[model samples]
Target: MTGERDNNGVVGVGADLDSLFAEVEALRELASDSDKARDSARVYDFGIRWGALLSGRLQRLAHYHHRGELTPHEQARYEKLRTELRDVQPLAERLGIARPTIPLEDRR
Candidate 1:
């Protein structure tokens, strides 16, 4: 089912981001010519795209949350999304990827 696959995709994105983080940490000591270093760069790129998609979803969640129509549980879900946005925002910049802009209260 589409919903099932979407859930898998979300999990996959998180996995990729974790792998990228591991690669980045490994890169700190490895030289550029090393195999691990090369693989890390590739994985890091993949992570960036995944992060962008995830970021977009988080932004939409924030938008809906600010609309003030959701239930308490839904509001909590959006707050979690905001937390995710904050986490990935720095990673995007460190990876040299364009950061996603989440429209918040000041913009409305």
Candidate 2:
């Protein structure tokens, strides 16, 4: 039998896969929250990287990964987010946000 399905009908993700989603989700939430707070509260990270890391985008990536359905464009996006987040994380923390150690991509 196939393992359990996620809400979107993705087959059961392993612990590590779940971790990947969690990391991406956290970063997305942080980015979105920071953007929302940019006008009022203090936003830590700077630049387009913040907008690039938005929840909606990351959520779509996760959904695509979940269904094991990534087009070339999406694959590029997946890699881009992972790389960009890695590149900008230190700056984000230095500027103010406390990021989690978990990475956006989980090793297979």
Off by over 4 Å in 2: 1-54, 98-102
Task: Summarize candidate 1's per-residue lDDT along 1-108 as a digit string, tens digits.
Answer: 111224222223344344434534433334333464356676476566556554654444444445554456555544554555455555545545545466423343
**TM-score of candidate 1 versus the correct structure, residues matched by position:** 0.44
lDDT tens string, model 2, 26-107? 5555556645545433353432444443443455456666666655544555566567567657655644554434356668
Residue pairs with clashing backbones, model 1: none
Whole-structure CA lDDT of model 2: 0.50
Q: Estimate each model's TM-score.
A: 0.44, 0.43
Give each model's whole-structure lDDT.
0.47, 0.50
Worst 10 residues of 1 by lDDT: 1-10
Q: Please give the lDDT score for candidate 1.
A: 0.47
